[model samples]
Target: MQRILLIDDDEQLGGPLASYFQRYELALTQAVKPSAGLALLREEHFDAAILDVMLPEMDGFELCRSIRKDNDIPIIMLTARGEVMDRVVGLELGADDYLPKPFEPRELVARLQSMLRRRSNSQVQDTQNELRFEGLSIDPARRSVTRQGEAVELTGTEFELLHMLASDSGRVFSRDDILNHLRGHEADLYSRAVDIVVSRLRKKLEPLDCIKTLRNAGYSLALRRLP
Candidate 1:
């Protein structure tokens, strides 16, 4: 059974959610306080975490930052506000995804499944083995991209974009689709931010010509070279 740690102050919602997830074959654990959640996290191993933004002792963002310091564990933030800034801040804070409150329980389940699926798929691909396309290479496990044998440093967003494009080479993904893939349940205000990340990625992959941008359409990776 997949272990999921849920941290939320709303006891009412948290109770039902725990029951709902338990029915779906997930071992659900709930922490009503941030401190308790942190304690559980340190003592136990969980596949993923569902965190609420507003907490009594300490905010979720602080908890998230603390978690990110040592754990790359996937995190899904729950926010009641649904503000764009809040979502962006969560993303920038290393949250894997965010879902606004007053949301369907089914939607939360779906998002959790998506996060797990992505992590599982990434692991199954042998990303630690390294991928080479012509002179370009990417090691997903190390989170490193290289061109012509030289290493290239990438931001988290840039690495994610590259991973998405590379995972399904030759598939045309729209900006909205890319944003959804990255943000999951989080609301994105600037869809054009996808283009910005792609541009930065393109610069890093300079002279490789692997990622091809389609004006007004989206992006597709060159499929013939890499393996």
Candidate 2:
């Protein structure tokens, strides 16, 4: 069973949700406070995390930021507001995905499964070669990146975006194309989602300047192959 952590103040939400998740072979652990959630994360292992935007001690964004400092765990934020800015902020803060409140249990489960599937697929590829560029390196099998011979820390989404562009360097990928590849679904909400990830990836790969953004076309890897 895949263990998942849920950090929401609604004590009532956890029990029923936990039972529902068991039907899909997922174990849900709940923490009503950010402190507790942070503690659980430090002490135990979870496949992913579900954080509520409205929480005690710190909001979901802060919690996401806190978690990113130490772990690259995939995070899905639950927000009642569902504003575009909220999604953008969460994505910028290193969340892998987000869902609005009052969502169907099935949909949440589907999102979780999709993320885990992508993660699993990346790990068991037939080809495990490192994609090397002028000053950057991407190891698909390890899901790791190196810039200028120094290891670069990337969230799951950021790494996937970088790898996607690196796989076909110089090929323009539309935002919709990138979205579908990352989320395994049609792009619906935030069009800037791809832009945010690209921006973050760009910052992380600083000094290399490998990712190039076309005026309106999309983004592509601009680095020359190191052979």
Candidate 3:
């Protein structure tokens, strides 16, 4: 049975949702506060989490950050705001998905199933470990990128940016889109920061020239060239 941690202050909603998920054989644990949620997360191994945007003591964003710092487990955020900024912020914080309030229990179940399916599929196909294009390769498991068989050092943020672009070769992503996809929030004052990371990644990938910059658009990986 897949284990899921649900953090929300809505006692009425949380109780029913737990029962609903139980019918599907998903072992569900509920916490009404961020600290309790965080504590549960640290003490147990959960396949995924559903967190509410508003919580006592600490908000969902901060909880998401705390969870992300230690695990790559998929997260789905619940928000009543339903704003683009909220969605972006949730995604930027490494959430796999977000659903606004007043959602149907059935829809939430579908989303949870979808996320679980994707997670399973990703794990099954993750045997390659290394993705090679030209002389550059990325080891997703280790979060490492290499060029010309030489190990290249990258910050977590930079690696994530490169991984996002390279994983979807030839797809054009605008700065705003990339920011949301990578940072999961609005392209704020630090939106241009993507450019800086791209520049640094380009410098490291000089030998391969696999990263292409689209003026006024965003970044894309050149069509994969097998080394």
Separate clash counts for every candidate: 0, 0, 7
Clashing pairs in 1: none
TM-score for all models, in order of appearance: 0.69, 0.97, 0.68
User: Global lDDT of each model?
Assistant: 0.77, 0.90, 0.74
Candidate 3 colliding pairs: 88-184, 88-185, 89-184, 89-185, 91-184, 92-183, 92-184
The residue-level lDDT of candidate 2 at 68 comes to: 98
Model 3 local distance difference test score: 0.74
Clash total of candidate 1:
0
lDDT of 1 at 23: 79
The per-prediction CA RMSD against the true structure, in angstroms, equals 5.0, 1.2, 6.6
lDDT of 2 at 22: 98
- Compared with the true structure, what per-residue lDDT tens digits does model 3 show for residues 1-227? 99999999877776777888988888788898888888988899998899999888888999888887767677888877546677667766667667888788877777777667745654455554567787788887767777888988664455667777777778987888766654444223345446666776777677677778888887898856464
Please provide the root mean square deviation of candidate 2 (C-alpha atoms, Å).
1.2
* Inter-residue clash pairs, candidate 2: none
Model 2 TM-score, all chains together: 0.97
